[model samples]
Target chain A: MALLSLSAVTLTFAGNTVLNEVSFNVAERSVTSLIGPNGAGKTSLFNSITGFYKPQQGSIRFDGTELLKLKPHQVTKAGIARTFQNVRLFREMTVLENVMSGAHCRTSAGAFAAILRTPAQRREEEEIRARARQHLEFVGVWAEQGRIATTLAYGHQRRVEIARALATEPKLLLLDEPAAGLNPTEKHDLVQLIRRIRDEMGIAVLLIEHDMGLVMQISENISVLDHGEIIAEGTPKQIQSDHTVIEAYLGRDDGEAFLDE
Target chain B: MALTDIVLQQLVNGLVLGSFYALVALGYTMVFGVVKLLNFAHGEVYMVGGFAGFIVLSLVSGTLGSGWSGVAVSMVLAMIGVGFLGVLIQKIAYQPMLSAPRLSILITALAVSLVLQNAVLGLTGGRYVPFGADLGFGGVNLGNLFISYNQFILVGTAGVLMLSLELFISRTQYGRAMRAVSIDKDMCRLMGIDVNRVIAVTFFLGSGLAAAAGTMAGAYYGSLWYFMGFLIGLKAFTAAVIGGIGSIPGAMLGGLILGLLESFGTQIPGIGSAWKDVFSFSILILVLVFKPTGLLGRSEQERM
Candidate 1:
């Protein structure tokens, strides 16, 4: 059974359709990639799934919960966590604090508990700190946890963002353009990290990427989106050979040469 | 009196006044930090808090003997009441307008302020209500300086409140969430944080601090008026700006500095006490011109 299923999800902004009847399913523990050219509504789909953009028509179900009815935070609580296309770490917070904030959903301490410093609250805080540190270490940014998040190198900031997302303990992770601005080394490390997140942590990943090499290497299944519609869904080999996907990407019939490269 | 003694006395006075400003300024800074809105109704919340404290005091003084304990009880109750009021105001007035233009929300804040002021005016017939309790009657005299019990209570309470707030922001789960939301609201949501709840809590803390300041101000000044929140609110805002509008420590420092400036500026041979406000506002203008980000405020470039 699918861990996440989106059926006929439609989103419109100011009477202009942004996403039109987009339907796909991410299987449990599977690595899936959504690939499309620019302005193909991949991020918009992610936003809808995360409850930032409420789709006008559709059902989004994750683990039997209707995510369409939930708010963004509720969606995160419901076991779907995502990193933005652009790194969005809290600029004012230290790297450790940034990841610790992700544990906020699982922790139940409120303002009063904190003000009074109850024993349970203290224990929970220690646990949260430990969990955050563990994720930071997993992402290989544990040494930079004391520095301000935005002050780090761009690649380190991206890793911190992923660790922060991982700290949420989501059943499924959505990474949008994770390799967008990385050097080759960072990209390779990110691929390894994504595999570790799925293989070791038992989390499924749904990625949106323009890097065909990364997508072909990492994704078990691929869904091709163009003009807000999914034109093809299959293995990376099938997508690379699909005439519609090739046409969508190269806007010509000779795109098979491009896909082979 | 010797010049040294006079300066010392003014220093004490300024510290007392600065405490109140810092307390209220915390509210401005915290609210702005999270929401990036200049909550004009904040001062009215402070004014309402003064009235709330006054009412609580009136009700409990007969049983509690009108002592420091009674004042403490009143302040606590007032903090809670005004904190809820602040939350309600945010939910009803500000939350809906979160997506609206900045000008519209600001105007709405002004409207809320007017509503609060008029409501109080109508209820009390626009009269100056005497605070009735004289908490400052006694004092400790040291050398040429005399510090009243009221000053002690004011400074002591404000100090404790500010310290508690600092701890709350730095160490608590909700506090960290508040900081995160301030930086990036959408990212906080992705972290499974209820941004609305964080904002509501921000309003609660900010309003509560202002309320504590209000209750103390009422006791110190011995009077409460419908218009009391106006000037002080502006001054607290000035303090927030001076300290950096989104910075908690900056607000505290700004408030103390503004208070000291007011205190010392009043003693400038020809200026006299009448021009004290002139000095306060002049400092504000100078800060705006010279250090627009205030003493502790980070530059936009640095923050970005």
Candidate 2:
């Protein structure tokens, strides 16, 4: 069974249809890239899956449980975590605080216990902190943990955002333009990080990226979107060779220019 | 009163007044820390606390002894009661507007404030009633320095509560979560925190503290009215701003400073006593122009 499956998912924002009968499945421990042009509603679909935007019509099932009825935090508790297209970190807090916050949902300590610092709460906090630090190390920002998140370099902030998301201990991780503003070297590092997160952590990775190079390099399978519909779906090599996919990318003048480049 | 006596008395009075300001200011700071908006109705919540204390004290007068224990019962009951009211306000007034404009929430806060105040006015006939002066414990007498028990309790309670709050924020996971949410709501949500719950918790704690101040005010000074929250609320708010808006310790330091300023402000021969508010607000303007971060706040860079 798919780890996360969206069935005929449709989203309309204020009468403007953003996702029209979009459907896909993210298999466990696999990397699936959702690629689309700027207006193709990639983020909208991600939002729908993550429970940020309730779809007008469709069903999102995670590990066989209906996801639409659950709140965003409940979905997180169900082990689905996501990053935003625009990075959102608790900028004023230290890197460690930002990442540890992701562990909040899974934390077993009740408010009273956490407030009173019972032995159990202390042990749980210690475990969560250790896990948070490990995630930071995994993302290569552990050394920068003391720094305020906003003060970090762009690439480091990106790493921190991913680390924060990873702290949730999700079974399926959604990456929204994770490599958008990275340099080539940072992109290579992020690609490695994504793969390690998948292979070592045994988590399925669902990514939405405009960077075709990064997407093709890391994704096990690819789905192309245009005008809120799935235009193409196949393995990376198949997606790279499809005629309609080529037309979707190169038929428009901008697409042709992109192809030329 | 002689100049020395008037000066000394106002200094004493202002410090006592500042304790109330500091107590109420903490709530505003905590709420603003997490939500980034002043809980405009916080003052009304403070008033509600006073009423809760009044009602509880009336009920417990004969059953509880008339000394410190009675007062203690009243304080605890008042805090719990007003804290509940705070939670209700969050659920009814602020929650719906969480995603709305900051201005809308602020207006809703003002509306709640108005509604509570008028409701009290309707019940109490807009008159000030004296509370039990017996809540005042005996005073320590220094030669010419007359310190009342009420003053001691007011300042001491505020101090202990503040220290506890500091320890709570620095040492606990919920505190850490609050700090995180204050810094970034979306990040907190993504972290698996129920952002709404954190927001509610913030209001509960903050309003609870404000209730403590309200009860102390009624007990220490012996009278309270429906509009009692307005001036006090403004001063506490000013204190919050004078300290960095969201910083906890900053609010305490700012409250004490404002107290001292008001205490000393009237002493200037020409400046006179009436200019206390003018002086306090002037300091706010100066701080805004110069540091902008207030006394302890660090300047934050914009996140793109």
Candidate 3:
């Protein structure tokens, strides 16, 4: 069954339609990829699902809740978390603190409880710290958890961002170009991590990636977006052979030349 | 008095005044940290806090009796009231303009300040309202130095408040969320933190601290006026900038440094008391000219 379903989501900004009648479903515990050429509204679809941009029409339902009715934070609270295309760790915070901030949605301590350090607040804090450590360990950055987040290497920072999102304990994790800046070895590890997140953590994954090799290897289902609409949706074998997707990536004339190979 | 004795006395006075500045400066720094808004009306929140405490003291002194206990009750109540007022101001005035241009929000802040000032002026008829709380005029004599009981209370209370605020920011979950929001608001929302609530709490705590300072200042100085927040507010902003505007520890340090500078600057034979503000402002200009990030502030690259 689909954990997330979008029906005819249409988003327009200042009379310019950024996303038009886009529809797709992310199955529970499945790895899905949204692939497109640049400015094909892939990120716009993610924004719509994450509630950053309210679509003028259409409904996004996640885990039986209408996401369009919720605020961005509320969407997160309803078990959706995402990472940015660029690493966005809290610069001033220690690595562990950045991950701990992800526990904010799941934890319930208010300002007064925190200021007073009530017994329950203390216990909850300890739990948050433990969970953050676990997520950091899961992403293999546990050793560097004490250092400032921004001081880390680019790859480690990406790992930290992943851990931070995982700390939110989302049912579905959205990763925007997770493999964008990684070395070949780092990309290999990310594939392993994505599998672990699905197989072990049981969190569904939806990602946007330009790396066709990584997407083909990891994605169970792929959706291709072009010019504010979905051009195709299928398994890796099906999408790789889709004539329209080839035209979308390569121009009509170039697509014919590429198909011969 | 001997030169050494005069210096010692000024040191004590500087500490007392520094506590107030530090308290008020925290509001400016914290609000700026979270929203990057100057919140110019914060001074008026402090002014309103003073009036709130005054009203609380007047109403309760008949029952609680005007003593240390009465002042305590009044300060607590005033802080709570003014904290809510700060939140309300953020919601009604600043929050909507958050997405507007930076200049527009700043103008709104100025408008809010003017409105608060005029509102208070109309209520009090621009007259000095006597605080009327007798916090005792006694003092401890240490050689040629005289330190009042009120000074001790003011510094001790401010110290405790500042320490607690530091702890709250460093150790609490909400505090961590606040730090994260300051760094990246949109990303923080992905972490499921209600960014609006964090900003509101920042205002609440900042305004509450200012209110505590306001109540203590009224009780110690024995006078309150509609325009009281104007000069002090600017001085506190100076202190925030000096401490590195968004750094919590910086605000406390800046307040103390500014207070000491003003205190000792007045002792110069030619400068005198009237030139106190001149010295404080001159230091602000110097800090801006040299270390624009303030003493504790990191550069933009490090901060963002």
TM-scores for every predicted model = 0.97, 0.91, 0.97
Instruction: Give the Å error, residue A143, model 2.
Output: 1.7
Write one digit per residue (lDDT tens) for candidate 3, span B92-192. Answer: 99999999999999999999999999999999999999998987789899997889888888899999999999988999899998898888999998899
Docking class of 1: high
**Model 3, residue A172: displacement in angstroms?**
0.4
Docking class of 2: medium
CAPRI classification of candidate 3: high
Residues B60-98 of candidate 1 have per-residue lDDT tens digits of: 999985678888999999999999999999999999999
Better of 2 and 3 by lDDT: 3
Query: Which segments of model 2 are wrong by more than 4 Å?
Result: A114-119, A252-261, B1-14, B61-64, B141-144, B271-275, B285-293, B297-304
Residue B250 error, candidate 1, Å: 0.9
For candidate 3, give the lDDT of residue B274: 90
RMSD of 3: 2.0
True contacts kept of each: 0.93, 0.69, 0.95
Clashes of each: 0, 0, 0
The residue pairs in collision within model 2 are none
lDDT of 1 by residue, A1-261 (tens): 999999999999999898999999999999999988788899999999999899999899999999999999999999999998789888868999999999999998787788778999999999999999999999999999899998999999999999999999999999999998999999999999999999999999999987788999999999988899999999978987788887887864434444765
Tens digit of per-residue lDDT, candidate 3, span A1-261: 699999999999999999999899999999999988888898989888989999999999999999998999999999999998998889879999999999999998788898788999999999999999999999999999999999999999999999999999999999999998999999999999999999999999999998888999999999999899999999999999998899787864444443444
Better candidate number, 1 or 2, judged by DockQ: 1
- Listed in order, the DockQ scores are 0.85, 0.57, 0.87
Weakest ten-residue segment in model 2 chain B by summed lDDT:
B129-138
